[model samples]
Target chain A: MKAKIHIMLKNGVLDPQGKAVGHALASLGFDGVNEVRQGKYIEIDLAETDRAKAGGVVDRMCKTLLANTVIENYVIEFE
Target chain B: MKAKIHIMLKNGVLDPQGKAVGHALASLGFDGVNEVRQGKYIEIDLAETDRAKAGGVVDRMCKTLLANTVIENYVIEFE
Candidate 1:
Protein backbone atom coordinates (compact mmCIF):
# COMPACT_ATOMS: atom_id res chain seq x y z
CA MET A 1 0.00 0.00 0.00
CA LYS A 2 1.05 3.60 -0.55
CA ALA A 3 0.34 6.34 1.96
CA LYS A 4 0.66 10.10 2.08
CA ILE A 5 0.88 11.83 5.40
CA HIS A 6 0.42 15.55 5.79
CA ILE A 7 1.81 17.08 8.95
CA MET A 8 1.29 20.71 9.81
CA LEU A 9 1.97 23.17 12.57
CA LYS A 10 -0.88 23.64 14.96
CA ASN A 11 -2.83 26.87 15.10
CA GLY A 12 -1.45 29.70 17.28
CA VAL A 13 2.10 28.52 16.80
CA LEU A 14 4.76 30.91 15.52
CA ASP A 15 6.41 30.02 12.24
CA PRO A 16 9.62 31.98 11.77
CA GLN A 17 10.55 30.09 8.64
CA GLY A 18 7.20 30.77 7.08
CA LYS A 19 7.42 34.39 8.00
CA ALA A 20 10.81 34.71 6.46
CA VAL A 21 9.53 33.14 3.31
CA GLY A 22 6.62 35.54 3.21
CA HIS A 23 8.91 38.52 3.41
CA ALA A 24 11.07 37.08 0.71
CA LEU A 25 8.08 36.65 -1.54
CA ALA A 26 7.07 40.26 -1.13
CA SER A 27 10.52 41.30 -2.11
CA LEU A 28 10.14 39.15 -5.20
CA GLY A 29 7.01 41.10 -6.17
CA PHE A 30 4.27 38.72 -5.06
CA ASP A 31 1.53 40.92 -3.71
CA GLY A 32 -1.35 40.16 -1.37
CA VAL A 33 0.30 37.17 0.26
CA ASN A 34 -1.26 37.78 3.62
CA GLU A 35 0.31 34.85 5.46
CA VAL A 36 2.33 31.71 5.13
CA ARG A 37 2.05 28.57 7.23
CA GLN A 38 4.59 25.86 6.63
CA GLY A 39 4.09 22.20 7.31
CA LYS A 40 5.32 18.74 6.34
CA TYR A 41 4.30 15.77 4.24
CA ILE A 42 5.49 12.21 4.44
CA GLU A 43 5.09 9.63 1.72
CA ILE A 44 5.44 6.00 2.64
CA ASP A 45 5.67 2.89 0.57
CA LEU A 46 4.35 0.00 2.55
CA ALA A 47 4.87 -3.61 1.67
CA GLU A 48 1.55 -4.70 3.06
CA THR A 49 -1.41 -5.62 0.88
CA ASP A 50 -4.38 -5.27 3.19
CA ARG A 51 -6.20 -1.95 3.10
CA ALA A 52 -7.59 -2.36 6.64
CA LYS A 53 -4.13 -2.81 8.03
CA ALA A 54 -2.91 0.22 6.14
CA GLY A 55 -4.89 2.64 8.31
CA GLY A 56 -3.59 1.26 11.55
CA VAL A 57 -0.09 1.20 10.19
CA VAL A 58 -0.43 4.79 8.99
CA ASP A 59 -1.86 5.93 12.30
CA ARG A 60 0.99 4.29 14.14
CA MET A 61 3.37 5.86 11.70
CA CYS A 62 1.99 9.31 12.47
CA LYS A 63 1.88 8.84 16.22
CA THR A 64 5.39 7.50 16.33
CA LEU A 65 7.53 8.58 13.38
CA LEU A 66 5.75 11.08 11.16
CA ALA A 67 4.81 13.85 13.56
CA ASN A 68 6.03 15.76 16.52
CA THR A 69 2.84 15.74 18.52
CA VAL A 70 3.98 18.64 20.62
CA ILE A 71 3.84 21.12 17.76
CA GLU A 72 2.15 19.39 14.83
CA ASN A 73 -0.80 17.27 13.73
CA TYR A 74 -1.00 14.76 10.88
CA VAL A 75 -3.54 13.25 8.52
CA ILE A 76 -3.01 10.12 6.49
CA GLU A 77 -4.40 9.15 3.08
CA PHE A 78 -4.09 5.94 1.11
CA GLU A 79 -3.05 6.28 -2.54
CA MET B 1 -8.63 33.63 -2.18
CA LYS B 2 -7.03 30.82 -0.23
CA ALA B 3 -3.98 29.08 -1.60
CA LYS B 4 -2.09 25.97 -0.66
CA ILE B 5 1.55 25.56 -1.58
CA HIS B 6 3.12 22.18 -1.17
CA ILE B 7 6.89 22.04 -1.03
CA MET B 8 8.85 18.85 -0.88
CA LEU B 9 12.41 17.71 -0.76
CA LYS B 10 13.41 16.55 -4.16
CA ASN B 11 13.69 12.88 -4.93
CA GLY B 12 17.17 11.44 -4.24
CA VAL B 13 17.65 13.84 -1.37
CA LEU B 14 18.50 12.30 1.97
CA ASP B 15 15.98 13.04 4.66
CA PRO B 16 17.70 12.49 7.97
CA GLN B 17 14.76 13.84 9.89
CA GLY B 18 12.39 11.39 8.28
CA LYS B 19 14.85 8.56 8.86
CA ALA B 20 15.15 9.40 12.51
CA VAL B 21 11.40 9.41 12.81
CA GLY B 22 11.23 6.02 11.17
CA HIS B 23 13.67 4.58 13.65
CA ALA B 24 11.68 6.00 16.50
CA LEU B 25 8.55 4.36 15.12
CA ALA B 26 10.27 0.98 14.90
CA SER B 27 11.29 1.37 18.50
CA LEU B 28 7.67 2.10 19.29
CA GLY B 29 6.70 -1.19 17.56
CA PHE B 30 5.33 0.09 14.24
CA ASP B 31 5.87 -2.59 11.64
CA GLY B 32 6.43 -2.49 7.89
CA VAL B 33 7.36 1.17 7.56
CA ASN B 34 9.46 0.65 4.49
CA GLU B 35 10.59 4.22 3.78
CA VAL B 36 9.89 7.83 4.69
CA ARG B 37 10.17 11.13 2.81
CA GLN B 38 9.45 14.48 4.37
CA GLY B 39 8.29 17.65 2.65
CA LYS B 40 6.49 20.94 3.32
CA TYR B 41 3.16 22.66 2.78
CA ILE B 42 2.38 26.33 2.89
CA GLU B 43 -1.12 27.70 3.22
CA ILE B 44 -1.72 31.29 2.23
CA ASP B 45 -4.67 33.58 2.65
CA LEU B 46 -4.93 36.03 -0.18
CA ALA B 47 -7.06 39.15 -0.16
CA GLU B 48 -7.31 39.30 -3.92
CA THR B 49 -10.43 38.17 -5.77
CA ASP B 50 -8.84 37.25 -9.07
CA ARG B 51 -8.10 33.57 -9.51
CA ALA B 52 -5.73 34.33 -12.34
CA LYS B 53 -3.80 36.74 -10.17
CA ALA B 54 -3.88 34.21 -7.38
CA GLY B 55 -1.94 31.73 -9.46
CA GLY B 56 0.66 34.30 -10.32
CA VAL B 57 0.90 35.28 -6.70
CA VAL B 58 1.22 31.66 -5.70
CA ASP B 59 3.85 30.98 -8.30
CA ARG B 60 5.93 33.91 -7.13
CA MET B 61 5.31 32.85 -3.58
CA CYS B 62 6.69 29.40 -4.27
CA LYS B 63 9.62 30.62 -6.29
CA THR B 64 10.69 33.15 -3.73
CA LEU B 65 9.18 32.27 -0.37
CA LEU B 66 7.71 28.77 -0.20
CA ALA B 67 10.54 26.74 -1.66
CA ASN B 68 14.29 26.74 -1.68
CA THR B 69 14.95 25.92 -5.29
CA VAL B 70 18.33 24.50 -4.43
CA ILE B 71 16.82 21.72 -2.35
CA GLU B 72 13.08 21.63 -2.92
CA ASN B 73 10.18 21.89 -5.35
CA TYR B 74 6.68 23.29 -4.88
CA VAL B 75 3.17 23.35 -6.34
CA ILE B 76 0.32 25.75 -5.76
CA GLU B 77 -3.42 25.16 -5.49
CA PHE B 78 -6.37 27.46 -5.03
CA GLU B 79 -8.74 26.73 -2.24
Candidate 2:
Protein backbone atom coordinates (compact mmCIF):
# COMPACT_ATOMS: atom_id res chain seq x y z
CA MET A 1 0.00 0.00 0.00
CA LYS A 2 1.04 3.58 -0.62
CA ALA A 3 0.00 6.31 1.76
CA LYS A 4 -0.08 9.95 0.82
CA ILE A 5 0.11 12.53 3.56
CA HIS A 6 -0.51 16.24 3.40
CA ILE A 7 0.72 18.16 6.40
CA MET A 8 -0.31 21.78 6.63
CA LEU A 9 0.03 24.53 9.17
CA LYS A 10 -3.09 25.14 11.17
CA ASN A 11 -5.00 28.36 10.71
CA GLY A 12 -3.67 31.32 12.73
CA VAL A 13 -0.13 29.91 12.83
CA LEU A 14 2.49 32.19 11.34
CA ASP A 15 3.95 30.93 8.04
CA PRO A 16 6.92 33.03 7.07
CA GLN A 17 7.96 30.69 4.29
CA GLY A 18 4.54 30.92 2.70
CA LYS A 19 4.54 34.67 3.03
CA ALA A 20 7.89 34.87 1.30
CA VAL A 21 6.57 32.81 -1.59
CA GLY A 22 3.56 35.06 -1.97
CA HIS A 23 5.78 38.09 -2.02
CA ALA A 24 8.05 36.49 -4.56
CA LEU A 25 5.13 35.70 -6.79
CA ALA A 26 3.97 39.30 -6.64
CA SER A 27 7.42 40.55 -7.48
CA LEU A 28 7.46 38.23 -10.46
CA GLY A 29 4.49 40.18 -11.84
CA PHE A 30 1.82 37.62 -11.06
CA ASP A 31 -1.19 39.62 -9.94
CA GLY A 32 -4.27 38.93 -7.85
CA VAL A 33 -2.69 36.29 -5.67
CA ASN A 34 -4.44 36.97 -2.41
CA GLU A 35 -2.84 34.36 -0.17
CA VAL A 36 -0.45 31.44 -0.12
CA ARG A 37 0.06 28.66 2.37
CA GLN A 38 2.70 25.99 2.01
CA GLY A 39 2.67 22.51 3.42
CA LYS A 40 4.31 19.09 3.14
CA TYR A 41 3.34 16.19 0.93
CA ILE A 42 4.72 12.82 1.84
CA GLU A 43 4.36 9.46 0.13
CA ILE A 44 5.09 6.35 2.10
CA ASP A 45 5.22 2.85 0.68
CA LEU A 46 4.20 0.22 3.16
CA ALA A 47 4.48 -3.51 3.01
CA GLU A 48 1.15 -3.99 4.63
CA THR A 49 -1.57 -5.21 2.31
CA ASP A 50 -4.69 -4.70 4.38
CA ARG A 51 -6.27 -1.30 3.89
CA ALA A 52 -7.34 -0.94 7.53
CA LYS A 53 -3.94 -1.96 8.86
CA ALA A 54 -2.15 0.41 6.52
CA GLY A 55 -4.35 3.29 7.57
CA GLY A 56 -3.78 2.60 11.24
CA VAL A 57 -0.02 2.37 10.82
CA VAL A 58 0.21 5.58 8.85
CA ASP A 59 -1.98 7.39 11.35
CA ARG A 60 0.39 6.37 14.12
CA MET A 61 3.31 7.60 12.06
CA CYS A 62 1.63 10.97 11.62
CA LYS A 63 0.85 11.43 15.29
CA THR A 64 4.24 10.23 16.42
CA LEU A 65 6.56 11.93 13.92
CA LEU A 66 5.04 13.09 10.65
CA ALA A 67 3.05 16.03 12.00
CA ASN A 68 3.42 18.67 14.67
CA THR A 69 -0.03 18.26 16.17
CA VAL A 70 -0.18 21.62 17.92
CA ILE A 71 0.69 23.77 14.93
CA GLU A 72 -0.05 21.54 11.96
CA ASN A 73 -2.75 19.23 10.66
CA TYR A 74 -2.32 16.17 8.46
CA VAL A 75 -4.59 14.28 6.09
CA ILE A 76 -3.77 10.77 4.95
CA GLU A 77 -5.00 8.79 1.96
CA PHE A 78 -4.18 5.27 0.90
CA GLU A 79 -3.66 3.86 -2.57
CA MET B 1 -10.64 30.71 -6.89
CA LYS B 2 -8.06 28.51 -5.27
CA ALA B 3 -5.12 26.56 -6.57
CA LYS B 4 -3.49 23.58 -4.96
CA ILE B 5 0.01 22.81 -6.10
CA HIS B 6 2.10 19.78 -5.39
CA ILE B 7 5.80 20.11 -6.09
CA MET B 8 7.88 17.01 -5.91
CA LEU B 9 11.42 15.98 -6.64
CA LYS B 10 11.81 14.08 -9.83
CA ASN B 11 12.35 10.39 -9.42
CA GLY B 12 16.03 9.32 -9.07
CA VAL B 13 16.93 12.45 -7.08
CA LEU B 14 18.54 11.83 -3.74
CA ASP B 15 16.17 12.95 -0.96
CA PRO B 16 18.13 13.06 2.26
CA GLN B 17 15.21 14.52 4.15
CA GLY B 18 13.01 11.61 3.15
CA LYS B 19 15.69 9.11 4.03
CA ALA B 20 16.02 10.66 7.44
CA VAL B 21 12.29 10.43 7.92
CA GLY B 22 12.24 6.78 7.00
CA HIS B 23 15.07 6.07 9.39
CA ALA B 24 13.34 7.95 12.15
CA LEU B 25 10.18 5.97 11.62
CA ALA B 26 12.13 2.76 11.88
CA SER B 27 13.86 3.91 15.02
CA LEU B 28 10.49 4.80 16.51
CA GLY B 29 9.56 1.11 16.20
CA PHE B 30 7.32 1.54 13.18
CA ASP B 31 7.87 -1.34 10.84
CA GLY B 32 6.92 -2.46 7.32
CA VAL B 33 7.82 0.91 5.81
CA ASN B 34 9.51 0.41 2.46
CA GLU B 35 10.17 3.93 1.31
CA VAL B 36 9.31 7.56 1.89
CA ARG B 37 9.38 10.57 -0.41
CA GLN B 38 8.67 14.13 0.58
CA GLY B 39 7.28 17.00 -1.44
CA LYS B 40 5.64 20.40 -1.13
CA TYR B 41 1.96 21.30 -1.13
CA ILE B 42 0.93 24.89 -1.67
CA GLU B 43 -2.48 26.51 -1.61
CA ILE B 44 -3.02 29.81 -3.37
CA ASP B 45 -6.05 32.04 -3.38
CA LEU B 46 -6.67 33.91 -6.60
CA ALA B 47 -9.05 36.65 -7.65
CA GLU B 48 -9.67 35.13 -11.05
CA THR B 49 -13.05 33.46 -11.43
CA ASP B 50 -12.66 31.58 -14.69
CA ARG B 51 -11.29 28.08 -14.19
CA ALA B 52 -9.29 28.12 -17.41
CA LYS B 53 -7.75 31.48 -16.60
CA ALA B 54 -6.97 30.39 -13.07
CA GLY B 55 -5.21 27.28 -14.30
CA GLY B 56 -3.16 29.23 -16.82
CA VAL B 57 -2.09 31.82 -14.27
CA VAL B 58 -1.15 29.22 -11.70
CA ASP B 59 0.80 27.26 -14.29
CA ARG B 60 2.79 30.34 -15.10
CA MET B 61 3.42 30.89 -11.43
CA CYS B 62 4.73 27.37 -11.11
CA LYS B 63 7.13 27.70 -13.98
CA THR B 64 8.38 31.15 -13.06
CA LEU B 65 8.64 31.12 -9.28
CA LEU B 66 7.14 28.10 -7.60
CA ALA B 67 9.00 25.09 -8.96
CA ASN B 68 12.58 24.39 -9.92
CA THR B 69 11.75 22.74 -13.21
CA VAL B 70 15.20 21.18 -13.53
CA ILE B 71 14.79 18.97 -10.50
CA GLU B 72 11.21 19.33 -9.37
CA ASN B 73 7.89 18.69 -11.08
CA TYR B 74 4.71 20.47 -10.04
CA VAL B 75 1.03 19.69 -10.49
CA ILE B 76 -1.61 22.37 -10.15
CA GLU B 77 -5.28 21.86 -9.38
CA PHE B 78 -7.98 24.46 -9.03
CA GLU B 79 -10.97 24.57 -6.74
Candidate 3:
Protein backbone atom coordinates (compact mmCIF):
# COMPACT_ATOMS: atom_id res chain seq x y z
CA MET A 1 0.00 0.00 0.00
CA LYS A 2 0.99 3.60 -0.50
CA ALA A 3 0.08 6.51 1.69
CA LYS A 4 -0.14 10.09 0.54
CA ILE A 5 -0.23 12.75 3.22
CA HIS A 6 -0.89 16.45 3.17
CA ILE A 7 0.19 18.38 6.23
CA MET A 8 -0.88 21.98 6.46
CA LEU A 9 -0.69 24.74 9.00
CA LYS A 10 -3.88 25.06 10.97
CA ASN A 11 -6.10 28.05 10.47
CA GLY A 12 -5.10 31.14 12.51
CA VAL A 13 -1.50 29.95 12.52
CA LEU A 14 0.84 32.51 10.97
CA ASP A 15 2.86 31.30 7.99
CA PRO A 16 5.79 33.45 7.06
CA GLN A 17 6.78 31.20 4.17
CA GLY A 18 3.38 31.63 2.62
CA LYS A 19 3.58 35.35 3.07
CA ALA A 20 6.95 35.45 1.38
CA VAL A 21 5.61 33.49 -1.57
CA GLY A 22 2.65 35.81 -1.92
CA HIS A 23 4.97 38.80 -1.91
CA ALA A 24 7.23 37.17 -4.43
CA LEU A 25 4.30 36.46 -6.72
CA ALA A 26 3.19 40.08 -6.51
CA SER A 27 6.71 41.26 -7.29
CA LEU A 28 6.76 38.94 -10.29
CA GLY A 29 3.80 40.91 -11.70
CA PHE A 30 1.25 38.13 -11.20
CA ASP A 31 -1.82 40.05 -10.20
CA GLY A 32 -5.10 38.81 -8.71
CA VAL A 33 -3.42 36.66 -6.09
CA ASN A 34 -5.01 37.37 -2.73
CA GLU A 35 -3.41 34.83 -0.41
CA VAL A 36 -0.91 31.99 -0.43
CA ARG A 37 -0.45 29.14 2.02
CA GLN A 38 2.16 26.42 1.85
CA GLY A 39 2.22 22.93 3.27
CA LYS A 40 3.84 19.49 3.01
CA TYR A 41 3.00 16.58 0.75
CA ILE A 42 4.47 13.21 1.58
CA GLU A 43 4.20 9.85 -0.16
CA ILE A 44 5.14 6.72 1.73
CA ASP A 45 5.34 3.26 0.29
CA LEU A 46 4.49 0.67 2.89
CA ALA A 47 5.09 -3.04 3.06
CA GLU A 48 1.76 -3.52 4.69
CA THR A 49 -1.07 -4.58 2.40
CA ASP A 50 -4.18 -4.35 4.58
CA ARG A 51 -5.88 -1.01 4.16
CA ALA A 52 -7.07 -0.65 7.75
CA LYS A 53 -3.74 -1.55 9.25
CA ALA A 54 -1.87 0.70 6.87
CA GLY A 55 -4.13 3.57 7.77
CA GLY A 56 -3.47 3.02 11.45
CA VAL A 57 0.29 2.95 10.91
CA VAL A 58 0.29 6.07 8.82
CA ASP A 59 -1.91 7.86 11.31
CA ARG A 60 0.52 7.04 14.06
CA MET A 61 3.37 8.28 11.93
CA CYS A 62 1.60 11.59 11.49
CA LYS A 63 0.85 12.00 15.15
CA THR A 64 4.25 10.96 16.37
CA LEU A 65 6.64 12.39 13.81
CA LEU A 66 5.18 13.73 10.60
CA ALA A 67 2.99 16.51 11.91
CA ASN A 68 3.30 19.10 14.63
CA THR A 69 -0.16 18.50 16.03
CA VAL A 70 -0.47 21.82 17.79
CA ILE A 71 0.22 23.96 14.75
CA GLU A 72 -0.48 21.69 11.78
CA ASN A 73 -3.13 19.26 10.53
CA TYR A 74 -2.63 16.27 8.33
CA VAL A 75 -4.82 14.33 5.93
CA ILE A 76 -3.91 10.87 4.72
CA GLU A 77 -5.06 8.85 1.70
CA PHE A 78 -4.19 5.31 0.77
CA GLU A 79 -3.54 3.58 -2.51
CA MET B 1 -11.30 31.09 -6.69
CA LYS B 2 -8.64 28.93 -5.19
CA ALA B 3 -5.73 26.99 -6.60
CA LYS B 4 -4.03 24.00 -4.99
CA ILE B 5 -0.66 23.01 -6.21
CA HIS B 6 1.54 19.99 -5.45
CA ILE B 7 5.19 20.23 -6.31
CA MET B 8 7.37 17.13 -6.23
CA LEU B 9 10.83 16.14 -7.19
CA LYS B 10 11.02 14.44 -10.54
CA ASN B 11 11.61 10.71 -10.50
CA GLY B 12 15.31 9.76 -10.51
CA VAL B 13 16.19 12.96 -8.66
CA LEU B 14 17.89 12.26 -5.36
CA ASP B 15 15.94 13.64 -2.41
CA PRO B 16 18.15 13.91 0.61
CA GLN B 17 15.37 15.32 2.73
CA GLY B 18 13.19 12.36 1.90
CA LYS B 19 15.95 9.93 2.73
CA ALA B 20 16.46 11.60 6.08
CA VAL B 21 12.75 11.35 6.78
CA GLY B 22 12.67 7.67 5.92
CA HIS B 23 15.55 7.09 8.27
CA ALA B 24 13.79 8.99 10.98
CA LEU B 25 10.68 6.90 10.58
CA ALA B 26 12.71 3.73 10.84
CA SER B 27 14.49 4.95 13.92
CA LEU B 28 11.14 5.73 15.47
CA GLY B 29 10.35 1.99 15.25
CA PHE B 30 7.82 2.26 12.45
CA ASP B 31 8.51 -0.67 10.24
CA GLY B 32 7.34 -1.92 6.83
CA VAL B 33 8.15 1.39 5.16
CA ASN B 34 9.73 0.87 1.81
CA GLU B 35 10.23 4.44 0.67
CA VAL B 36 9.31 7.99 1.54
CA ARG B 37 9.14 11.02 -0.73
CA GLN B 38 8.36 14.57 0.22
CA GLY B 39 6.91 17.47 -1.72
CA LYS B 40 5.24 20.82 -1.35
CA TYR B 41 1.58 21.70 -1.24
CA ILE B 42 0.52 25.26 -1.86
CA GLU B 43 -2.82 26.97 -1.85
CA ILE B 44 -3.47 30.30 -3.51
CA ASP B 45 -6.56 32.43 -3.35
CA LEU B 46 -7.22 34.30 -6.56
CA ALA B 47 -9.51 37.15 -7.50
CA GLU B 48 -10.07 35.63 -10.91
CA THR B 49 -13.35 33.79 -11.37
CA ASP B 50 -12.78 32.15 -14.70
CA ARG B 51 -11.41 28.67 -14.24
CA ALA B 52 -9.52 28.66 -17.51
CA LYS B 53 -7.79 31.93 -16.81
CA ALA B 54 -6.97 30.90 -13.28
CA GLY B 55 -5.42 27.70 -14.52
CA GLY B 56 -3.31 29.62 -16.97
CA VAL B 57 -2.16 32.05 -14.32
CA VAL B 58 -1.31 29.28 -11.87
CA ASP B 59 0.52 27.34 -14.54
CA ARG B 60 2.62 30.36 -15.30
CA MET B 61 3.32 30.83 -11.64
CA CYS B 62 4.59 27.26 -11.42
CA LYS B 63 6.74 27.62 -14.48
CA THR B 64 8.26 30.90 -13.41
CA LEU B 65 8.40 31.03 -9.65
CA LEU B 66 6.79 28.14 -7.86
CA ALA B 67 8.69 25.22 -9.30
CA ASN B 68 12.23 24.58 -10.35
CA THR B 69 11.20 23.02 -13.67
CA VAL B 70 14.60 21.45 -14.11
CA ILE B 71 14.04 18.93 -11.29
CA GLU B 72 10.62 19.53 -9.87
CA ASN B 73 7.19 18.76 -11.30
CA TYR B 74 4.07 20.64 -10.28
CA VAL B 75 0.39 19.87 -10.61
CA ILE B 76 -2.28 22.54 -10.16
CA GLU B 77 -5.93 22.07 -9.32
CA PHE B 78 -8.66 24.63 -8.78
CA GLU B 79 -11.49 24.73 -6.33
Candidate 4:
Protein backbone atom coordinates (compact mmCIF):
# COMPACT_ATOMS: atom_id res chain seq x y z
CA MET A 1 0.00 0.00 0.00
CA LYS A 2 0.98 3.59 -0.55
CA ALA A 3 -0.11 6.39 1.71
CA LYS A 4 0.11 10.11 1.08
CA ILE A 5 0.00 12.43 4.03
CA HIS A 6 -0.64 16.14 3.85
CA ILE A 7 0.28 18.02 6.97
CA MET A 8 -0.34 21.69 7.50
CA LEU A 9 0.01 24.21 10.28
CA LYS A 10 -3.17 24.51 12.29
CA ASN A 11 -5.32 27.58 11.87
CA GLY A 12 -4.05 30.48 14.01
CA VAL A 13 -0.55 29.03 14.17
CA LEU A 14 2.24 31.34 13.09
CA ASP A 15 3.79 30.36 9.74
CA PRO A 16 6.84 32.42 8.98
CA GLN A 17 7.85 30.24 6.05
CA GLY A 18 4.48 30.75 4.46
CA LYS A 19 4.77 34.48 4.95
CA ALA A 20 8.18 34.52 3.29
CA VAL A 21 6.85 32.54 0.32
CA GLY A 22 3.95 34.94 -0.04
CA HIS A 23 6.33 37.90 -0.08
CA ALA A 24 8.55 36.19 -2.59
CA LEU A 25 5.58 35.53 -4.85
CA ALA A 26 4.49 39.15 -4.64
CA SER A 27 8.00 40.32 -5.52
CA LEU A 28 7.91 38.03 -8.51
CA GLY A 29 4.83 39.97 -9.75
CA PHE A 30 2.31 37.44 -8.60
CA ASP A 31 0.16 40.20 -7.16
CA GLY A 32 -2.96 38.08 -7.06
CA VAL A 33 -1.59 35.99 -4.24
CA ASN A 34 -3.19 36.89 -0.95
CA GLU A 35 -1.59 34.35 1.34
CA VAL A 36 0.63 31.31 1.16
CA ARG A 37 0.36 28.57 3.75
CA GLN A 38 3.04 25.94 3.52
CA GLY A 39 3.02 22.40 4.78
CA LYS A 40 4.44 18.91 4.24
CA TYR A 41 3.47 16.18 1.84
CA ILE A 42 4.76 12.75 2.76
CA GLU A 43 4.50 9.63 0.65
CA ILE A 44 5.16 6.32 2.28
CA ASP A 45 5.46 3.03 0.43
CA LEU A 46 4.75 0.10 2.62
CA ALA A 47 5.71 -3.52 2.29
CA GLU A 48 2.53 -4.67 3.91
CA THR A 49 -0.46 -5.28 1.67
CA ASP A 50 -3.27 -5.45 4.24
CA ARG A 51 -5.43 -2.38 3.90
CA ALA A 52 -6.56 -2.06 7.50
CA LYS A 53 -3.10 -2.82 8.83
CA ALA A 54 -1.49 -0.28 6.53
CA GLY A 55 -3.97 2.39 7.56
CA GLY A 56 -3.36 1.68 11.22
CA VAL A 57 0.39 1.91 10.78
CA VAL A 58 0.10 5.17 8.92
CA ASP A 59 -2.23 6.64 11.53
CA ARG A 60 0.24 5.80 14.25
CA MET A 61 3.08 7.26 12.21
CA CYS A 62 1.20 10.53 11.88
CA LYS A 63 0.31 10.74 15.52
CA THR A 64 3.78 9.92 16.71
CA LEU A 65 6.10 11.73 14.32
CA LEU A 66 4.73 12.98 11.02
CA ALA A 67 2.52 15.56 12.69
CA ASN A 68 2.82 17.79 15.70
CA THR A 69 -0.81 17.48 16.72
CA VAL A 70 -0.73 20.67 18.78
CA ILE A 71 0.32 22.88 15.89
CA GLU A 72 -0.49 20.90 12.74
CA ASN A 73 -3.27 18.89 11.15
CA TYR A 74 -2.80 15.91 8.87
CA VAL A 75 -4.93 14.23 6.25
CA ILE A 76 -4.11 10.85 4.74
CA GLU A 77 -4.90 9.37 1.35
CA PHE A 78 -4.42 5.63 0.86
CA GLU A 79 -3.85 3.73 -2.35
CA MET B 1 -9.81 31.44 -5.04
CA LYS B 2 -7.77 28.79 -3.31
CA ALA B 3 -5.04 26.78 -4.96
CA LYS B 4 -3.28 23.81 -3.47
CA ILE B 5 0.13 22.90 -4.85
CA HIS B 6 1.89 19.64 -4.20
CA ILE B 7 5.60 19.59 -4.93
CA MET B 8 7.66 16.42 -4.99
CA LEU B 9 11.18 15.45 -5.83
CA LYS B 10 11.80 13.80 -9.15
CA ASN B 11 12.41 10.08 -9.05
CA GLY B 12 16.03 8.98 -8.42
CA VAL B 13 16.79 12.06 -6.35
CA LEU B 14 18.41 11.27 -3.03
CA ASP B 15 16.17 12.28 -0.14
CA PRO B 16 18.13 12.24 3.08
CA GLN B 17 15.29 13.81 5.01
CA GLY B 18 12.98 11.02 3.98
CA LYS B 19 15.52 8.40 4.92
CA ALA B 20 15.89 9.95 8.35
CA VAL B 21 12.14 9.92 8.77
CA GLY B 22 11.94 6.29 7.79
CA HIS B 23 14.71 5.42 10.22
CA ALA B 24 12.93 7.31 12.95
CA LEU B 25 9.76 5.37 12.30
CA ALA B 26 11.64 2.10 12.48
CA SER B 27 13.18 3.06 15.79
CA LEU B 28 9.72 3.88 17.03
CA GLY B 29 8.74 0.26 16.24
CA PHE B 30 6.71 0.96 13.12
CA ASP B 31 7.99 -2.05 11.19
CA GLY B 32 5.77 -1.81 8.14
CA VAL B 33 7.56 1.20 6.71
CA ASN B 34 9.35 0.38 3.47
CA GLU B 35 10.37 3.67 1.92
CA VAL B 36 9.56 7.26 2.73
CA ARG B 37 9.51 10.38 0.57
CA GLN B 38 8.74 13.91 1.65
CA GLY B 39 7.74 16.98 -0.25
CA LYS B 40 5.95 20.31 0.08
CA TYR B 41 2.31 21.25 0.21
CA ILE B 42 1.57 24.88 -0.38
CA GLU B 43 -1.89 26.38 -0.17
CA ILE B 44 -2.38 29.79 -1.70
CA ASP B 45 -5.32 32.06 -1.18
CA LEU B 46 -5.66 34.40 -4.11
CA ALA B 47 -7.42 37.69 -4.58
CA GLU B 48 -8.27 36.83 -8.19
CA THR B 49 -11.64 35.21 -8.76
CA ASP B 50 -11.23 34.05 -12.32
CA ARG B 51 -10.23 30.40 -12.41
CA ALA B 52 -8.13 30.63 -15.54
CA LYS B 53 -6.08 33.58 -14.31
CA ALA B 54 -5.51 32.00 -10.93
CA GLY B 55 -4.29 28.86 -12.62
CA GLY B 56 -2.00 30.77 -14.92
CA VAL B 57 -0.44 32.69 -12.08
CA VAL B 58 0.07 29.52 -10.12
CA ASP B 59 1.62 27.78 -13.08
CA ARG B 60 4.10 30.56 -13.51
CA MET B 61 4.84 30.50 -9.82
CA CYS B 62 5.60 26.81 -10.02
CA LYS B 63 7.73 27.02 -13.10
CA THR B 64 9.75 29.93 -11.77
CA LEU B 65 10.04 29.59 -8.01
CA LEU B 66 7.67 27.11 -6.41
CA ALA B 67 9.51 24.16 -7.88
CA ASN B 68 12.99 23.46 -9.13
CA THR B 69 12.00 22.12 -12.53
CA VAL B 70 15.20 20.13 -12.82
CA ILE B 71 14.56 18.12 -9.68
CA GLU B 72 10.92 18.48 -8.77
CA ASN B 73 7.43 18.35 -10.22
CA TYR B 74 4.37 20.20 -8.93
CA VAL B 75 0.68 19.59 -9.23
CA ILE B 76 -1.84 22.34 -8.63
CA GLU B 77 -5.44 22.02 -7.54
CA PHE B 78 -7.81 24.98 -7.94
CA GLU B 79 -10.97 25.91 -6.15
**In lDDT terms, which candidate is top?**
3
Which docking class does model 1 fall in? Answer: medium
- Candidate 1 regions with alpha-carbon error over 4 angstroms: none
Error of 3 at A46 (Å): 0.5
lDDT of 1 by residue, A1-79 (tens): 8888888888888888778777877788776778877777778878887888988878876776567899988888888
Model 3 lDDT, residue A40, Cα: 97
Supply DockQ values for each candidate.
Answer: 0.73, 0.93, 0.94, 0.86
Q: Which lDDT tens digits does candidate 2 get at residues A1-79? A: 8999999999999999899999999998898999999999999999999999899999999999999999999999988
Rate residue A10 of model 3 by lDDT: 99
Question: Model 1 chain A, poorest ten-residue lDDT window?
Answer: A58-67
Q: Could you give candidate 1's per-residue lDDT for residues B1-79 as a string of tens digits?
A: 8888777788888888778767776788776878877777778888888999878767866675567889887878888
| Candidate 2 lDDT tens digits, B1-79 | 9999999999999988889999999999998999999999999999999999899999999998889999999999888
Chain A TM-score compared with the true chain A, each model in order = 0.91, 0.97, 0.98, 0.94
- Residue-level lDDT of model 3, residues A1-79, one tens digit each, is 8999999999999999999999999999999999999999999999999999999999999999999999999999998
- Clashing residue pairs, backbone N/CA/C < 3 A, model 2: none
Listed in order, each prediction's TM-score against the native is 0.83, 0.97, 0.99, 0.96
Give me the chain B TM-score of candidate 4.
0.95
Q: Give one digit per residue, the lDDT tens place, for model 3 in B10-68.
A: 99999987898999999999989999999999999999999999999999999999999
- Can you give the lDDT of residue B12 in candidate 4? 99
Angstrom error of the Cα, residue A15, model 1: value is 3.3
